[model samples]
Target: MRTTKLIWTIVGAVTVVLLLAGVGIVAALRGGDDEPDPQAAPGPGAASALPAPPSATSPAPSPGADITGPLDLLVIGVDTRVSIPDWQPHADAIMVMHINEDLKSGYIYSLPRDLRVDVPAFDANGYGGGRRKLTEAMSSGAKVRGTDKADVAQGYELLAKTISDYTGVDGFDAGAILTFDGLSRLTDALGGVTLKIDQKVVSQHRRPDGTARKLRPGGGGYTGPQATYLPGTRTLTGWQAIDYARQRYTAGGDYTRQRHQRQLVRALLTKAMGAGLPADLTRAEAVLTALGDTLVVSGDRNAIEYAYALRDLDPSRLTLVGLPGDSVINNGRYIGEQLTPVGRGFLKAAAAGTPEAYLADHPKLINK
Candidate 1:
């Protein structure tokens, strides 16, 4: 049987939004067959420790009602090893989703990982305020004194605050942390994603068979036969999808990677909404369990509940925004990235909830 509109209520707007950050809850709501079980909830404690919604004081909506928006959500993807004790993870990917008041459309944009900015002091970690790469905010904030384990939540808090300050946004209404492992599992859970590769890219980290390339002697870089992707539409497995999205050595550098990431999110959402997920009970269970294990959501409501509220959201309406930047240099050495004046203007417009207007004037910033 084909998935009906009812299942859409459970896989709604936030599904695409969360996909940008590698959070997977679509499988968590699936029933034994093609239809979704409305009563299903994500695994216990999947969402926790998040701030209340912007309208927390307002009367709560009745069951199955959509929530009002004009809200901002911050998403961070970190590549940290679980086996390594006291490991401090940096933000490998930082993206933001801004929802319009109409709740019908939204804008998604990425901040370059190497963008240099002022990271505020974190009392918990004794980090003094200083200029640093945007990626370092999370690592600096995650530091703990003595035997205290590294705190990812605290890291997220710092990263969100830094981004909010930089973008002129008052604050983020919701946030999520996506681990590297979760990303692979989520992609695999959906069977795979079919995306159009904009350009040819060669892997700098992996070999042809999807195994890790051997490290060069003395630790300069990986060495082996690399995987290469040609420009075209192709269905990618989890690892291939991630590797392709992570290519920064391409022509456009990090900007190209950012564009690919957004494209991957759109493809994943399109597949899920088209009822492309597996109908078998065993596969569905594995997807749900893997998603639950890797996702950490921060919001007033659980991810499943949030999905219901965003049910009317049309993923097709999302606009992918790219902020152009130039390399920051000092003493003839590249230090970091700095947004161009146009990029700054875009951020200002986004904070004012008028990104659509800004993009209309600066169509070049809109990613095709």
Candidate 2:
């Protein structure tokens, strides 16, 4: 799901598009033949308070290690200008999905962009030390690394490391990075999606003095006219959905924005799961050709295989897990957030393959 953004918000959309638009990517692949194994990891109350979540039954894989059975994917969405050639990207969202070998049910955990973290320094900048925001780890890592695709790769390198180090699960079995515009393009490729809205909100387009810049009242959006999101279910075009998910001026601010992004992905997943992409090679290739070079997915081939499996996965079996925390001022000046010990435990539970157990203790954290 998103950049400065709908953090961890776009995977559902990616799942929807790639499964439908890029046939060769998924058609030749198959879900793992392993049987579904949902043995409970240590319950939250029984677990020790480690720096991060302990691994599931099997030992955790080291960073970048490929493992059989259950898989954990660190999904990243970044803001980038890939066409510019020189415009490297920065992560807008960071989300992790953990699934059992059976590929039946999975947990999606969204880490906040402004959540304070201990960011490691790059060779160019040296060690950052002290506490920093989790969002800066990648940009800081890229600064020290090379400027070519190497830079983006370094960013992810640091990103995956930082997240794993913080969460304390074995390192990710696979990971993926997406440019921000990929959301809009992919959503458009899927036609449009219907999103469920809790409270109403208007698009976040304002002039210097904070006056409304758009008033088209629904339908097309982003580059041109758009409308306020009324409470209820509404069908949104690619841009309209993007605009709706991008809005942060409403009550919940970025949190609400994150929520909307998840809703958008859910809608897209609904569409993707309903499609017969495997049977429509011609249409898939056409869709991919139409959106040439707009989306760049890099890192972890295993992650792509997971996408292949996602084409047939049930959307209802997936759940979004939000990190609960209060906004705070870090180092007195920087805006950041932190979770309570139990909240961190919930995160640990999610990472450790026991979200259902953690949610049993903290039901409020579950997506309503």
Candidate 3:
């Protein structure tokens, strides 16, 4: 058990994250034209294209078709540091939000960043297929488009396409990419979030033996005296929340990190409802600007209407699950994660709007 309370960390800036965190930003601002630009690699048009919005009467397009009711928004959170010049980002956390037309029921799924995949060649990033982490798909796709020229929009398109292929789902209705900055600011703004940790966790990098050291814990940055999270519930600041979510050193590895993120998501949701952050446009905008400097967002009016319809949604209705997979160092080079049959079934079932049914038969992570 573990948790991180990152407000904006749940989704893109204020708009998308608010939607997933279960709030009222569905009435979008056209000014959001500033979203990142991503161009899909040639072919696999099925993977890169966004179809038109569906009518209220029509159900969302089947797995691969255009936007329809009961939409799935693939929100990919990239943990990149702007302080580093020309830092290529990887999709740190991949979350797909499935909401029904009524918005009464919703679900979230987190795809481990290190989940492995076979990436085809793209001229911009220059990769010719073999095996690569699922998180690498965006940057690889962006590279073919030109590092300087590549934008998050194109990155999202490629990543969405790849996820669709991996899960055998149709197209994703909307997609957005958030960053660690969002997580930090949201946590800070909310005055910290409370999450539960199942077991004592110490960084393999910093506190390998679950003992505190004169270090900054497992997370990469900062100068501090070791980061340690005792099992049970704890309230965390923005940066601390990010650090907690960054830990992937336990025997569970990435799975542990994924659970930490979900915990944060729930904490944020609880905070947002009580804190009224979304209703506070000024502070919310400032937080958005600080966290999501650049984001890729796509969707149609139909999706928006449903978002509006979900205004009074109860956070309890939200469901969280991880794709089924086993860690492996397949081939000599490929490493990290591989999908299991159960995971594929979950994805397929999720796309078909029946995740709870699958969960009824499977185990769920802590706080999910």
Please report how far candidate 1 places residue 218 from its true position, in Å: 1.3
Off by over 4 Å in 3: 1-15, 19-68, 120-130, 144-150, 203-224, 277-307, 331-334, 364-368
- For lDDT, the strongest prediction is 1
Please give the lDDT score at residue 301 for candidate 2. 44
lDDT of 1 by residue, 181-256 (tens): 5666677777788888878999998898999899899998899999999988899998898889888999999999
- TM-score, predicted candidate 2 vs. hidden true structure: 0.72
- Which of candidates 1 and 2 reaches a greater lDDT? 1
- Residue range 103-127, candidate 2, lDDT tens digits: 5567666777777877765555464
Query: Looking at model 3, how many pairs of residues clash?
Result: 21
lDDT of 3 by residue, 1-368 (tens): 11111122233333354553333352333235345323322335354456533333533332222223465666677756556666566788777767766555676778878887766555444656557788888776654334454455555556776777776557765566676656667677667878777777754333433233453479665453466778878887776677777787775778778767766775676677676654666655555565454433334333334344455555567676766678776476547877788877787777666777878887753144
lDDT of 1 at 106: 85
Give the TM-score of each candidate. 0.81, 0.72, 0.70
Q: How many backbone clashes does candidate 2 have?
A: 5
- Write down the worst ten-residue block by lDDT for model 3: 1-10
Error of 1 at 116 (Å): 1.2
